[model samples]
Target: MKRENLLVLLAGICTGLAALALTMLGNPANMGFCIACFERDIAGAVGLHSAAKVQYVRPEIIGLVLGSAVTALIAGEWKARSGSSPALRFVLGAFAMIGALAFLGCPLRMVIRLGGGDLNAVVGLIGFALGIFIGTRFVRRGFTLQRSYPARRTDGAVLPIIMLGLLVLFVAAPAIFRLSTEGPGSKHAPFFLALAIALVIGALAQRSRLCMVGGLRDTMMFGDAHLLWGFAAIFVTVLVGNLILHKFSLGFGAQPVAHSSHLWNLLGMTLCGWACVLLGGCPLRQLILAGEGNGDCAVTVLGMIVGAALAHNFALAGNPDSVNEAGELVVGGISMAGKIAVLLGLAVVLAVSVFNSRLGAKKNG
Candidate 1:
């Protein structure tokens, strides 16, 4: 096996093990790492939204950015660049978050949910692939977001510096943050420990260039399974770990932090998958790129944070299935508003894809 592929496989193994460890140590079930969920929690903690139950500064996020930044610097791979449709990228980022929240997780978490045997994630996986397939069609037709230019080192360091401040606030000035007393936000592994694990995962991901969206996109576009190997390793590792730990529950209902709204699950992920393709990376990949001094990706990350805030504020996020006081299964899903938002997201992304494609530009010219 090539060294790069092996590194990716190792990264996947470590990621899966980290997720399992964090869960055992008190993070939400099948939620050892979720870029969307953690970012949403960070938004709430910083008063971006009023979601009381999901407010906290997740150290894993802080660690991921910092870890990647540090690793890039050490590897001499850090370079500052920006200016490729920043405004559009930000909007796309927002819509991506909106879609992911509508489905209750990002692509990474979707895979993790699958490892834990959630059948709903299987539905999400199908939709995600379909979305990627649609995006690839545009790519084959010469879809392009244009080129980015070189930037100042400080511009690239902005996100890392911000993450450092957040870490300080998380560790030193916790009183200023609105910590969740209950719900998923309240459930977490130890702060330093989670941070430490995430730092390692970030370093590994940076080295291996691990990305779930890239895995599917590359396979479709170039018949390359190089990136997919990492996710495959992750799935196998998590599946074994869950089974050994008795955390594997194969069913559609009663899963933690998930809904049985199969249609929304499919559509939401479809939107997320499509938007990420246009953005040129998944949420996790965006974070890693931002850390490596891509100012445009940093903007996208900021947009995702705000998008998460807006989701909760506007009731666009999905609700999980729950048992009611009457001892009956109460189905949980997105509201009409959320449904509209997802459909709107799809329309907006489609428009972006068309306008950005070379064929569309040529026809207009």
Candidate 2:
């Protein structure tokens, strides 16, 4: 195999092993590596959301940022840059969170779910693929967030600093930052182990550019299956690992941390997939870029944090059986508020895709 293929394969193996380790050691089932879910929990930990059951500053998340930063710096790949439309990316980040929470996972987690034999994630995977496909249409039409520019080195180190601060807070047992008393927030692998695994996974991912959205998009658009190899590795490794460990169980019902609303799973991920493609990267990519000093990506990360807080406050998130703010929006076993949120997201994504497109700029010129 070529060197690039080897690196991506290594990255995928690292992702699967890390995810499986976290789960086996006590992280939530089918959720050893969900950026959105972890962010929502972090929001709760910081009192951004008062959802007490989900409050905890995840060490893995902090590790991801710092680890990526260290790796990029070591590899001489670190670059501080920004300039893409910050506000639009922020809103898109929020909507992306809304959609992920509705689906109960992000693209990575969707794959993880599939590896664990949750068929519902199959529905979600379809939706996510469709969303990326739609976003490709926008890409073909010249959708652009504009160019990024160089920035100070300090900008690149911000995420690592913040992550270190959070770690310090955790150590000091600060009352200011809420630590969970129970629920998913309370369950965790050994902190040091989780951190180490995240560091390894983040470093590898940074180097390999492991992105599910890019993987699918490239395959669909360019017939290039290079990115797919990483995903395939992740799936195959996790599937085999789960089977060997007796963690594999086929079916939609009784899947841990997952709901049975198949359509919502599909639609929610669709919104997420479409938004990620238009944003120029997935949530994982955003985090990695932020570590390398991309201010725009950092802004998008902040948007996701805020979106997580808002999702819980507005009763837009879902649990094992139902979504919050249950009412007329519920249809096809999915909430109506959820439905409208997705529709609005689609409109915003479409609007951005068209209006900010290079085609529009050319027309004006």
Q: Cα lDDT of all candidates, in order?
A: 0.92, 0.84
Model 2 error, position 12 (Å): 0.6
The local lDDT score (0 to 100) that residue 160 gets in candidate 2 is 72
- Report the Cα lDDT for candidate 2: 0.84
lDDT of 2 by residue, 241-313 (tens): 8999999999877577777788788888899999999887888888888887788888888898898898777
* Candidate 2 error regions (>4 Å): 322-334, 358-365
Per-residue accuracy of model 1 over 1-365 as CA lDDT, tens digit each: 99989999999999999999999999999998899999999999999999999998998888888889999999999999998899999999999999999889999999999999999999999999998999988977778777899999888888889999999877788999999999999999999999999999889998999999999999999999999998898888889999999999999887899999999999999999999998888999999999899999999999999999999999999999998899788889999999999999999999989888965457546
How big is the positional error of residue 87 in model 2, measured in Å on the Cα after superposition? 1.1
TM-score of each: 0.98, 0.94
RMSD of 1: 1.5
Candidate 1: 10-residue stretch with minimal lDDT: 356-365
TM-score of 1: 0.98
